[model samples]
Target chain A: MLAFQAGNLGAFQALFAKYQKKIIQFCHRFCGDQAMAEELAQEVFLNIYRGAAGYRPKARFSTWLFQIAVNVCLNEMRKEKYRHRIDSMDASPETESGKPRIKELCDPAPDQNELLEQQEREMMIQKALMGLPEKQRLALSLRVLNGFSYQEIGTQIRCSESAVKTLIHRGRQHLKELLENLYAGGDKS
Target chain B: MTCPYETWISAFMDGELTPQRADAMADHLAGCHGCKAKYEALTGLDQLLQSLPELKPSEQFERTFWKKVADWEENRSRRRLADWFKRGWRTVLAGSLALFILVFVSVFQGRFTRSLSPEEIILAEQMDVLQQYELINNLEILENWEAIAGEDESS
Candidate 1:
């Protein structure tokens, strides 16, 4: 950032090259739309570029980056508050296992049934996450999806670390209730 | 809600609980099926969230973003340049106005002062004796005016 402040354009590019994917991923998970997330990510970089001169090395650059990203996302979500589109879970995963999935899942290329099941579960989770209030959703996504520590999540969200833990806990409890209502044979609810 | 350590179950799922607290929670879960179910549900959600795919932007994301940044910087510089010009022009105009007012006031200050001051009035009276400046300036031409007019008439 100081390099960019010192007029090294390549430093700006280097920052973008290093963080574009992570930033886009964070925005996508926060907003749940690739195109909108891409736009938000662009806005974030523009903000960073505009504010480069004022950039103090307060925390990790990544943490600061996420702070800007989260602020931009919150603004975008405020503007689009009523436009949320829930990913429909018409085929919420039909699993008989007591646990959701024990082992970590990574499929380079899954068969069709596995793909369909995975897609359904992903959609259901997205829908559940959408039902959450924006702050809770952001906290939960940062913690669970992005794997940010509570302190870092607090930094991005402008709350205490303990508050972050509370947000995540409440967010997860709320999401579990939603998912269980949808998939745990309490579908009648 | 059924167990006292339910919050610990959440903290434990994230590996956030201290060892002593974690041991206590593990003991609670072992004796209580309901709390264990709650723990499973919480961890299940965590697992599902972690398993969700890491998303990526479109392939042109980098190119488009860099291009936008360049455009933004260009526009910002242009704006700064324009603002500099705006402020520069304003200062120039203000300076000119101040100078004009000063010159205007100065040109008339002696006249105004002579009206009210004894020294200026005496200086003005002494100077007013040489009032026909233009006549004195054209004295040589005026002395030969009759001869010049006669020559023109003859031509």
Candidate 2:
């Protein structure tokens, strides 16, 4: 980052190559939408590039990067357009009926049952994730999905380390219950 | 059923606990079924999260990003140029106006002084003193008048 800040384009490219996929994945896990994830990732990198001159190494570069990523994700989630998308997913027929909406599922041929099942499970998981409170969802994703330590997650989310632990603990419990309820509802149907 | 050790189980899994506490937790988990079950469920949840499918950027991601950067650079340069031009124009306008005012004031002063006789210039220069000339001339007399009045009163 210092190198990039000093007018080294190669350094910026190296940083981009190293973190592009990670940022995309983090955003994707945070939002549960691939397109939106890509958009947010671009915005994150653009912000980094634009603000490179002002960059200081107060924290680990990854921590700083993920802090920006988390902020971008949170801001994107707050937008009415993205909020409506999440709400629509929450009210989608698959979630309500506990059965994969035919139109929403992969090709429903018997040969594709495994694929269909996988897609359905993934969908359910995404919905279960979206159902979590914003802080829990952010904390849990930072830990389990993005693989940041509790302290790193705390710094990114602006909470104490103990608070992060509690958030993740509750987040995990909430996620488990949500997934179980989703699967149980599916089983009943 | 909520277990007091539930959050401890999470911390223990994440290795955030001290070794002594971790050992105690392990021993407790070994003897307790409820906490053990909760631990397993949490472990599965972690696995589920880890199993989320990985996504990659499309091939055009880099190209698109660079194009955006280029466009941003161009726009920024243009804006800066415009700002500089605006400042330069303003300075030029201000300088010209100041020069014009200076020239006009000097020229007006020279013309007026030339048009005036030497006596008129002196009168103009001392206009404030001249306006109070009568009062200033009588000031000493006025000061003594109070003393004369006092003498007359004594008499």
Candidate 3:
């Protein structure tokens, strides 16, 4: 970051190369749309570019980057108004498996059963995530997917450490309940 | 008894409690059915979360993103230059228009003002003549009418 601030394009490129994947994944999980995620990821980098000159070492660079990402995702969510729609759709038991079971049922790809199963699980998880409130989803994703500590999540999410913990706890509990409801017939015992 | 059990259970799960606390929690777990069930659930969640696959970016992500960044930078610079040129042109056009209007008005106001119809000029001149004649007649009548009325009254 210091090198990039010192007008080193290579350093900037290096940072971009290193974090591009992680940023893409984060945005994808947050928005659940690959194309929009990529666009938001680009926006995140652009923000970093615009703000790089004033970059202070107050927090870790990743924290700052993720903070920008979280803001972008939240702003997009607000502008799109898809959260409620997604929540309602996801709340239905049909999309509960992390896979697109409906899609599979309509078009059975016999050779790709494993792939279908994985897709189902991912879909289910994503639907459950969609059901969570934005703040809780952000907190939980930062903690569980990104492996960020509570302090780091707090910094990125602009909340207190205790508040971050509470968000994660509540988020997890919600996920647990949702999953339990969806997979009620499965052996939880 | 201070419930060493509860504290240990939380600490053990978080990996924050001391080894002693962890051991105590482990010991309590062996005897306590309720705490054991809670511990199992937490462990199950932890394992499930850990086992989830890490999502990777698509193959073309880096290339595509950097290309976009470059394009964005180029477009931004170009936009700035274009904006500057636009503002400059607008200022020049505005100044030139203002100057042309000033020169046109200054040179043409007399011609335009003088170009009123003959009837209008004639009307204005007649109005002036009428005003002068009315003023003189009023003065003469004021000077003689009172004397003439006095003579009639004597008669």
- lDDT for A30 in candidate 3 is 82
Using TM-score as the measure, the top candidate is 2
lDDT of 3 at B9: 48
User: For model 2 chain A, where is the 10-residue window of minimal lDDT?
Assistant: A100-109
Return the candidate ranking by lDDT, descending.
2, 1, 3
* lDDT tens readout by residue for model 1, A1-189: 889999998998899888887888777667655667788899999899889989999888888888899899888876744264323223322222222321223346667678667766776776677778888998887777767888898989999988988888888889888887778653555
lDDT (tens digit, per residue) of candidate 3 on A40-111: 898898888878898999988898899999999988888745455454554543433354433433234445
lDDT, residue B73, candidate 2: 95
The weakest ten consecutive residues by lDDT in model 1 chain A span A95-104
lDDT, candidate 1, B1-155, per-residue tens: 35677766667777778899988888888999988988887887788887777664566677888798779879989999999897889889999999999999999997787554787677578775557666677898989999999999999
Model 3 residue B20 CA deviation in Å: 9.3
Error of 1 at B60 (Å): 2.4
Measured with C-alpha atoms, the lDDT of residue B132 in candidate 1 is: 69
Candidate 1 positional error at A159, Å: 2.2
Residues B123-150, candidate 3, lDDT per residue (tens digit)?
6778877678768778877789889899
Error of 3 at A144 (Å): 1.6
C-alpha local distance difference test of each model: 0.77, 0.84, 0.73
